[model samples]
Target: MTTSKRPQNRADWQALAETLIPSLETRAFIDDAFVDAASGETLETLNPASGETLAHVASCDAADAELAVAAARAAHARGDWARLAPAKRKRVLLRLAELMEAHKDELALLDTLDMGKPVSSSLGDMAGAIGSIRHQAESIDKVYGEVAPTGDDSLGLVLREPLGVVASIVPWNFPLMMTAWKIAPALAAGNCVILKPSEKSPLSALRLAGLAKEAGLPRGVFQVLPGYGHTAGKALALSMEVDCLSFTGSTQVGKQLMQYAGQSNLKRVYLECGGKSPNIVFADCKNLDKVAKRAAAAIFHNQGEVCIAGSRLLVENSIREAFVDKVVEAAKAMQPGNPLDPESFMGAMVDETQYRRVLDYIAKGREEGAQLRAGGASLEGPGYFIPPTVFDGVTPAMTIGREEIFGPVLSVFGFDSEEEAVAMANDSDYGLAAGLWSQDIDRIMRVSRRLHSGQVFVNNWAGGDQTVPFGGVKQSGNGRDKSHHSLAEYTELKTVWMSLQG
Candidate 1:
């Protein structure tokens, strides 16, 4: 008897390598069915890894946002989308998931070219995007309204309905995945959505609109407007026609969005903003080297572009030096290179502006009397890349410690006691996510409970399961993504009270 052999892990990736194309360009999907932008301008997308021009994205202005919003409102009012049954909508979402999976390689390449994340990581992001859509699709029909107990003569019912005309603004970092996170749930909830992808990385979002169309979604139900944040993003925030706004970006921009919502109309605003999250390493941590390695990866992943990066390293004073040494070694091992290369770990920053911003922050750290352990300047190339940097003696007051650099820069600080560590962790205005590395269950429970963050990791850095809610506290913005809580955000409740007349 003979049996077929299963492919090894190396062979699996090699199979995917056959599908990878070096030059794949997905043109921006404009809603030709709707009116064009009044400005009649275009924005050029650049490959941050090589500084080469990629594609020309539509430069949508206020008028363009208005057109998109009007189309969404019309789609909702006409019941072209919002009237669909939850199960039918779920089917459409499932089709979308299938389409995304079919074109995973193309989408991954587009993401790498536009945003400068490693191809390996970009592929993972594409997979996660598909998973998010599929997860939301499966859960859409499971959402049910409550039926209140009432007298025999009458019935009391509660209805959960979609918030129509949703405006989704996604950040450049994790562009494809974040867009799917917002649009999938919004559409599954029966809302017509207008998506605004960040100008820096708009390719995947545009391609997603095309995929949604292919999935049997009606026109005007899903639209993509790629432009500057000030114009397109602000328009969505302030538009009275838009029912609610979902945004993911910086804390400063989140505040501006809140102001816009208040100034124009009191639209519900949901944001996932910046984080200066702490990665605490206690003396009793099992596998100290492994913890340190993960800690380095958490901060340096995507060139530290993630909103939940463990940028602030808080270690017990007893083991601070050793942990720092390990972390520095791990950081040194990651070499920045072309995002399309499978071997590269670190990639370029989003653009010149972000590159300069990270450099300036590093300079500020040095001026504030912090010791620069490694890498402090930009790489010499056509692309916008920064080396992995680490700063020692980082006080809470220093700019590098407080601000979101959004680059491959780690700031290390030491604390003597558990109380001090917790205090230092909670010192930041942003409370997105925090991590604790320790073997003691008591320490994990205590520190996890004390930390002022939305998500906490025990003996790990970044691990997101579909079942758990992900978001932030305080200035990190309100509302949750993933889990059942995200489903609640897309819906509105209506209660019907009945009185029995005997």
Candidate 2:
């Protein structure tokens, strides 16, 4: 129990961290038992905030991935999961969600320590994760397949069957919440799942598997393998036996997985990848203050690690300076500090790699002749901390404006007309999400329809309930997460034609 450099407020989380951090089992949870990586390799998980060792987790490779897939297949064949009634599965997941909520504080702490997200923000992420799991569980039995009308002589049926073995590869950012987004629906749809958590943030996902088991989820129906994408994740994608794979991460990695799917048994692959989202504001927006505040939160929240971060500020030329000033004012207030501190709005970058990458992007922005408005330098601390940065006079051709930095960096570009705004927003190779702030219904309607993004937030900057379908268009990747659409992704559509066809 190393609490020497850690920040502790509100005795509960501190106590829980003390209790869990020392006793962490770094081994992968496979077939209901903790085991070492098949390669006998280990990865040391660190507290991104304090640069302290949390645990040395097992790094599962292809061989271990094979073992997990075999277990999942056998379990599905034995009807350990797939044969459960929809209602029964729903109950099991409901209990799982309840257990997760009960230990929300502990889970939130683990999330914060593992990935340098603010303690407060991690707590909110846990709440959302619970809601996502519960929503899917509650809706499992309520959703019904359609029955088509047929001739008097025969009947036609359309049904959705579980896709046997499902594999989920989640990102380091919002690890637990992304896990909930993928696996909850997969479970409710009566499919066995193999969760491959990012090696950088595997603690909460490992704990979640234990919670699922505690809620009476059958053995082999759920398993967690902590490893890198190239080894374990590739194995899942390369497996002919794996029915489907759901992934969340970078677009480059997403494209690689898609190619792996083609080279393998052609398993179904759904990806929610990178974004350089445009947060456009028209002069007609009713609340510039609200826009400035939320827009700052949008780019600086989670250290700007979000896939749908509003990184590009596309403002109308008429009010560009005023809005930029307000945004700069807001960003200057979000200081990166100790993740465990309750008052800290921003936290460290997830690790040194991310920290270096953000610094590199900041340098690039300066080299490309963009105006540096707010904080841009790394903070003096033990942790990997970088202050929120704003760049004005950014051209679409610049690297900062075009690339996904995945850090607290904002690039502002001005447009004179609606056509120019839409053009600049759509010019990027990525289009996961876009945000627009305008009160005019006609303008909102027109721009919302014209944008190529998967989601266009009207008044809000970044937000989505579990009921909404999420995923991106173009290079942002294919398919959808959340909502019944996500639940449906884990099932195979089968149409039964009767004698009427003959």
Considering every candidate listed, which one attains the maximal TM-score?
A: 2
Model 1 agreement with the true structure over 1-502: per-residue lDDT tens digits: 0113322343443344344323322333444353345777888888887777877767888888888888788888888778888788889999999988877866876788788888888888988889889988999889889998876888799998889989889999999988888887888888988889999988777767777888999868998888889998888898998889999999998999989999987989999999999999899988878888899999999999999999999999999998899999888888687676677898889888898999999999999999998889888968998988999899999999999989999999999999999999999999999999888888889999999999999887878766778899999989788777798899999998776774
lDDT of 1 at 499: 68
RMSD of 1: 4.1
Where's the lowest-lDDT run of ten residues in candidate 1? 1-10
Off by over 4 Å in 2: 1-12, 500-502
For candidate 2, write residues 147-211 as lDDT tens digits: 77987778778999999999999999998999999998899899999999999999999989888
* The 10-residue segment with the lowest total lDDT in model 2: 1-10
Q: Report lDDT per candidate.
A: 0.85, 0.91
* TM-scores of the candidates in the order shown: 0.94, 0.97
